[model samples]
Target chain A: MNDSMSTRDSLALAELVELQDVSAVAFSGQRLKPGRGSNLQLSVAAGFALTEQALSYKFDLDGSLVDVDENDPLVQLSLSLVVTYVPRNANAENWVGGDHERLKAFGDSFAWPAAYPFVREGVTAILSRLGADAYQLPMLRPSDLL
Target chain B: MRSLYERVTATLKGARAVAAARLRHEVLALLHQAQLASRMTQSDVARELGVRRSAANQVFRGDGNIRTNTLAEYLHAMGFEADLRLVRAGEPRQAALEQRAVRPAFEDWRIRRPQPTTSGVFVTNEGDDRPVLVRWAATGRTESFRVEAEVTTLPAANSFTPLGKRMFTT
Candidate 1:
């Protein structure tokens, strides 16, 4: 067996990890409504989670032969963001059930993309109202990072 | 009435969309703030990042659906390092065991604890021995100590120890 090649292969295997999906999410913040002139502020926080198998692959760089599963993800990452919206003139509307679900799905496989537009549109609308067009965020694709 | 599966699926979809939107807003807002603070025009950023001015503009406008690497590069140009932290949430027992087994005793330096949001993020001073402190938000539980600072080149091939002895340990 070629010792160097074996080590190289093992390291490559470790690097060949993929992002599966947002396993879970928890966030705290309020919703910004359309048609209301409001100032919005947000803080984005992200975290990472790794399985035991993935951990083994990372530190066990001794070129030792070990079982490798292509289908399993070595790590899971969680992104939590909180957006605070202050209305310029008017009391805030009552919070509803959909808000909780909105936060939960932020980490879900199917719902993340669907919810992106709402925030974008909200920002655009509010900024347009304020006559400030300078702020914008780059669109991010989760799969590409994997 | 909708089927249970159908309802659950719809709800999940709604939640995902909202969460994604919020994340997008936060990221864009931060980038915008960074751009203002740096006072570097889109062209300036493009030159530094080696992209076209138009491409830099697209990123600023939030039109680019950026990949993680691209985002890291953008942040790097602006003098910030993107650090994503992942901590095992449910497995307290496993976390404890790993913590005890892996961490080395060090006094002068300590691994920055993961924040309520994310932790162990550092900005490079751009010194010769730019101490790189890597915390595995996903995998590695241990943070390293900086025993000493030495000059070395990163290997392109299969050399066992990579970048031997820098200002910081990883």
Candidate 2:
């Protein structure tokens, strides 16, 4: 993947992680589903990671938080991060196992900061330009996951 | 000697007409109070609701039968609360029947009836004989009209002769 596209996709994935965080927070306020073991999953299809990130920022502006538990059966943390990228410019048939391997490697690396506070702040800043709040994203630790 | 079927049918028809007339009067009384309190013309209300003036007039005149949701919306627009009360079926029937009977007499005596401001009308037009009497307060004019064809002629027409004279001469 091109360096610019990779950076864009990574940022987009980070934003989705942010929104899943906010939903967790709002749901937490209601105390409907409590405990840190709760998990929120976001599926990013392909070309709309930017759109999803923008949406996440919008939710943050509306005072939402995302919370997850360490012992969650699926992904664990005070947050979650998932990023999958399909080549937008390249022909699908031309791609090989090497591309998949690269994506998996990128997913692991990109997922970390994407699940953290800095990306959330960045999203908040973007949304603030549109007259919304810039909320602090909660910190997460790998040890918190089971 | 009336048949059982005829008695049942007449009772049902009477109940329906009474219900319908009561609804009409309730709606009119509400609109009348709203008009007096707010000093708002029918056109003003119509404009606010994005409806035609005639539609608003119909609402005030208690002419159109409206849906509950639409009535609710109108009530909301007018800053009124819609409350539902649960009462015994027999209680409502008795109260409604009494009100239905006494209302015309009150109007005939030129007495001011106690009417609260409300948004919607409740009507049940089941019965065959429905008598509706409307009196214009300003002109002291009284008009008695009935829904039934058999009872179309006015009852005690002479009782209103004074009111008729007062309305026509001046």
Candidate 3:
């Protein structure tokens, strides 16, 4: 993640940008039969998603209680959010250089932070509703992400 | 966010691909279930249908524009039939009841709709939230490849469970 912001994060953030929108691209949470494991398996995948107006970054967060049966995710939730940003001047989508690292960096600093609250709120509400085990999505500082 | 899926569905070619993909998706599911229920293999379906193993495999894999009659024939060979039904939309509970009470929606898809084909198929391996990228050229035909840092050729559907396959002309 350190190298992610090396060339683009500053530039993307430096330019006046609008967190133009945040929308749920996908959301599904189910509470299946009780499972054996108590652990929470969490996976977070981030990437750049092009928008009509600008370039956007999307984050997918999947959390499921640890279970012996892979099919049985006692309590599971998957959320995908796209955070679109309108950067000053250029069409954000056109500005991307197709560098994977740069796009990832842009997602980390710009997309993740803006989308984190919504993600956390979503996860909290679902798990709470399901009456599943209590756990918090860690609030990671920039350095903590490294 | 505009996914490769959105990009593919935005044009006429993409519209054809979407229709084809949807049909193919349903066909593959039926093929899998029917074969499993009958304890038959693709080769068996081929033998029953008097086609090459590859041809039978093609239909099973959703590789080509398989015809409605062909789907019925394939299912008949395996001791099943395609059933299409019309249901009215209603409340969530009503919809759930209708889903259980009526015949499957897609089984009839293979029995009713005309199939579509394109120059290429966008094969999606399991775990991709959206189509990140596609590499092409398979067995002298236009097939899909995946690139998420490394470029990996798509595997056979049997080997890898493709959650979805969206086909389109270049």
Per-residue lDDT, model 1, residue A19, is: 22
lDDT of 2 by residue, A1-146 (tens): 66567556545433333222211111111222333222233221111122211111111112222344343232111222222222222233433233332333234344333444543554344334433334444454442211
What is the lDDT, from 0 to 100, of the residue A119 in candidate 1?
Answer: 37
Clashes of each: 12, 13, 0
If the candidates were sorted by their lDDT against the true structure, best first, what order would they fall in?
3, 1, 2
- Model 3: per-residue Cα lDDT over A6-66, one tens digit each: 6456465536455555666677788886643466676776666443334566666777865
Off by over 4 Å in 3: A1-9, A12-16, A35-37, A67-72, A90-97, A143-146, B1-170
lDDT string for model 1 (B1-170, tens) is 97553454477675466546655765677677777777878788899988999888888788857666777787778876654433332232344557854232243334464332122222344753332322223323356323322222221112221111111001
Instruction: Tell me each candidate's i-RMS in Å.
Output: 17.1, 39.0, 18.0
* DockQ of candidate 3, scored on C-alphas against the true complex (2 decimals): 0.01
The TM-score obtained by model 2 is 0.26
Give DockQ for candidates 1 onward, in order: 0.01, 0.00, 0.01
Using TM-score, rank the candidates from best to worst: 3, 1, 2
Q: Of models 1 and 3, which has the larger TM-score? A: 3
Show the lowest summed lDDT stretch of 10 residues, model 1 chain B: B161-170
Q: In model 1, which regions exceed 4 Å deviation? A: A1-146, B1-10, B85-170
Name the top TM-score candidate: 3
